[model samples]
Target: MEHDLPPVLSLDIGGTKLAAGVVTFDGLIHGWQITPTRREEGPRPVLARLFDLGRKAVAEAGLPEVAAVGISCGGPLDTATGVLECPPHLPGWIDVPVGPMASEAFGVPYALENDATAAALGEFRYGAGRGTSTMLYLTISTGVGGGSVIGGRLHRGAAGNGGELGHVMVRPGGRRCSCGRLGCLEAYASGTSIAERAREALAAGRASSLSAVELPTAEDVSLAAAAGDPLATEIWDETTWALGSALTDLVNAFEPELVVLGGGVTRSGAMLLDPVRAAVARDAMPPAARAARIEPARLGAGVGVVGAGAVAHDLLLSGKSDA
Candidate 1:
């Protein structure tokens, strides 16, 4: 059935970039293209460019025609209605009819999904999570976002935003989250938060290698911590602690077989993975800890494109879209 499915055009809309590719059922991407988002230009022009990029991808892939188009972006969104509802990353983009617009552009059926939820499906079907029935995926990038696959199916909670794992409370009444909540995981564990914390520390006159950099980022903090900078180490340690604490709770609650960590910040590799793994092993219930194997995502920078493609494939297989 998978072999018979036609290739689909996949589009990923992010705060910083836009990517497009034609993805086959085998999860191989072709004619991949990318460009800066320039989000300040607002939704209309950005969407126009996205559509053009999709056309270019289709033309370059040299396929007869795509079966469908899949769009993946940050949420809160209405999957059933194909509308984006004020996603934080895309400011001033409210109630955008993306699904129908994409359908009109490509003249094919379209399926829209939350970016993290789509990435979870991508990993489950084609990447690190293959063959696992229950898995959790966390993207620790500009903002922390997550999704899960339970019993081999994507779990898009009643809100259709997956579980919003990033919003899990880690430190009650601590740092404020973008979601207006205090001490949510995103407030402490996200790349944005990591950089912000380091900058705050430097601003308070704490001395460290980070002081040399004009604008220290999460990567800078990780590097400084690895080199034994005390301030950076403290910040890095706290970052891992928050992630570990939240993951321990999730592991106990979901009892997943795998936990995949993806996104830019995860590029620190062992620096991030080692401590998080150790914490889960030490704090989570024995059974849950033993069952969950924490690993890095394998799809790399193209995950969003692949994930969007996976969503389109599912849409076709479901027979809900005439494409």
Candidate 2:
């Protein structure tokens, strides 16, 4: 039966985008499709578009049929029941029954998982964590998310959402996070936070090159910093500092062999990685610091779709007969 398992359809829902692909058991993706979420349109329209995209991907992949469907999305969701429970990113989407909707649309069983949790499994089974027994994954994009594999098993925590790595407190009574926390890592280090910090600095009448760019983004800040802009440098350093501080705690707590960082913001590469690596090395417990290796994610733009596919692959192997 294992050898006879069929490739599955994978869908990833994000605040800003939606993606679909057909993924085989071998961890390869085919016919990937991407489109803007336009989340303001709400669940029904979005779900219809997502299903249409899945159909397009299947057709493009030239597959006669898929064994199952796997969906990955931001949470505060109930994975067991397949409900989307008011994720902060997708404003106004409360308790949408994504799993049943997806199953009905695709005419197949569906596996629903937290996006970050699924990504951890994706990286663990196919990417940077292939050889490691314990690994951690963080996605620092529009928001922050984390997942882990401990002792060679995916650790979904008690809530089944795995870990909320972004919520780690980095500053007491600091900037308000989307989670309503006063000082979460996401408040200071997420791509949104980075840009917000810059805009706030400019609003405070600080002089810097970033002011020249209208509505500057995190990428703009990194580019400005690379060009020797003092304001951008300050913001970038603070971002790295927050990441370093949080990563130190994670490395110490998880003691993973590898920590893979991904998502849009990591495109800055060394400018982002070098300082975080240094901070973890200098601050984490010696055993943890020496044992952990932090690296960028390998899946890049396709991670969500590939991760969703990985979830489906695991579901196929789970043998739970959930169809």
Candidate 3:
């Protein structure tokens, strides 16, 4: 029965882009296609475009048919009912029934997962967490998000979205988070926060090399910091400090064997990882610190699509609802 399952069509929805791929049971992807999300167009148009992307991916892969579709997107979503509640990234897109729509479009069942949770499963199954019993994954892109695999199983928690690791309180009464909370790790370590802090500093007229650039991004800050720009250094340090502090807490709490960091921010590689590693080594409980190794994600930019495909593959195997 398991061998009879068809390859899965996977879609990943993000604020900046939409990606689709045909994924086999082996966790390999083929016929991947990517396009800008252009979310200003609202849900109907975006979903239509997304479905079209799916069809294109299916056609490109030369598969006869796909058995299931798996969708991954940012949360505040209902995995049980497959409704996407107002995720802050996709502003003006609220309560869209993406799962049913995707299922209907494809004539197959669909599984919707929080992007980070699906990524965690992705890493656990095929990336850095492979063969490990417990692992954690964090994505530090436009926002910070996290998920955990514990006791050799994906942990979705009671809320369906397993862990809001980014929401960990790093500075009480400090910067406001998109979750409407103050002092969240996401408030400080996310790429958006890095750029905002740089912009705020520049707006206040702090003289720095970044002053010459308009709307610098986190990569810009990282590059500037690497080039010895003081302002960028400050921002980069604070970002790493926040990540280390939060990761220290998470490593202590979970005692995972590995922690995988992904997303656009991690492109800085050693610049981002070395400092966090140092902080965790210095601050976390000795046992937990010794147990966990933080590393960059192996799946790279395609993790979202692959993760969604993995979710669909799981659906085929289980024939049951997600946690």
lDDT of each: 0.95, 0.91, 0.92
lDDT tens readout by residue for model 2, 221-283: 999999999999999999999999999999999899999999889999999999999999999
Structural similarity to truth (TM-score) of each candidate: 0.99, 0.97, 0.96
The candidate that wins on lDDT is 1
- Indicate the residue-level lDDT of 135 in model 2: 95
lDDT of 1 by residue, 296-321 (tens): 99999989999999999999988999
- In model 2, the runs with Cα more than 4 Å from the true position are 1-4
Task: Give the count of colliding residue pairs in each prediction.
Answer: 0, 0, 0
Off by over 4 Å in 3: 1-5, 321-323
Decreasing lDDT order of the candidates: 1, 3, 2
Candidate 2, poorest ten consecutive residues by summed lDDT: 314-323
What count of clashes does model 1 give? 0
